[model samples]
Target: MLKGKHEIMLKTSLGDITLVLDADSAPKTVTNFIELAKSGYYDGLTFHRVIPDFMIKGGDPNGNGTGGESIFGVSFEDEINADSYGLHKLKLGDATDEALPEELAEMTQKEYLEKQGYIFNDDLKSLPMEKGYIAMANSGPNTNGSQFFIIQRKAGTPWLEGKHTVFGKVTEGMDVVDAIANTEKGANDMPVEAVTFDVEVK
Candidate 1:
């Protein structure tokens, strides 16, 4: 079982980047990530998506931003900080502008939100989605798998707060992340030249 915090070293073709996973805050997600790394699941996986001002994403075995699975072969719920949302706030900042249904106000926050299709696993500390922030990428609520991304810009991405699970932070080598993010890319935001990874959990 994972205890306390853990550090992961990601040796990329661009450079080495170090990540600090908050196992206490996101136990399941952190465990999944560590297991994947230890099994060499991320070896040779290319950074399939890169947006200069946003983030760099990878962990897709197919290297095309299309394929990957959790060690459990099932999707996991998000570990988000509920406090990030003010007690009275009702809507998310995304394009959907999804808001709490008035009819479900009587239900608890978790129940009401789950009824709305949000699946949260834990209510831990919230990490600002600023540069170097690392988080899982999902299609929607509770779809977290192997795909993950590192925020590349210094500005905070408020729209992402509470929407995705922020499980780790880049404790060192942000410059390497910036380099990968700034690299040339072809179609589908894929790097023109492959930027592969060698992940290790320590």
Candidate 2:
């Protein structure tokens, strides 16, 4: 894992996971996470959404993937780009005109994305959404709150490159993540038994 100024110990019901956060690439997002963790905001939060080959998501006060707000009491913009982590060229999502809003239909993908408040940072590269990487979970553009996910897919979810903000990676205890991924899940991939975690900033 990359060396970073911020590290967090996530003590879960399953086990402990140590994460190293990159504030260089994602300053505001990292700051938001650290402040939230320090404020006891993530205590008792359950990993509400767990997919076997995907990720385990949590930090929702509602514990149902629909709640929690940032310390600023508002959503924040994404600090990422379409090309990073060795991805040379742009590999965009389904940004075809038909899939875009009517107002964005005539604009280029870059224009549409920028219009939605996503800033592309070329100087500081963001980490890929691969195994052990930790990132924010959002409903859409700039909607990041307290929700976050840990990547479990060893190959990584490349399609998420330009979408989510990957601020850190697990430096230890990935077995704990694997164990949580194996937990039985019900509707919406919600764990049948609650899997809770607390954060300790270091």
Cα-based lDDT for every prediction: 0.81, 0.84
Point to the candidate with the largest lDDT.
2
Alpha-carbon lDDT of model 1: 0.81
Candidate 2: tens digits of C-alpha lDDT, residues 1-202: 2235698999999999999999887887898999999999998899999998899999999989889899767687777855564334322334432465555455555555666667677777787789999999998888888899999988888767667999999999999999999899999999999999999998
Candidate 2 residues lying further than 4 Å off, grouped into runs, are 1-4, 85-88, 91-117
Worst 10 residues of 2 by lDDT: 88-97
* TM-score of every prediction relative to native: 0.85, 0.85
TM-score of 1: 0.85
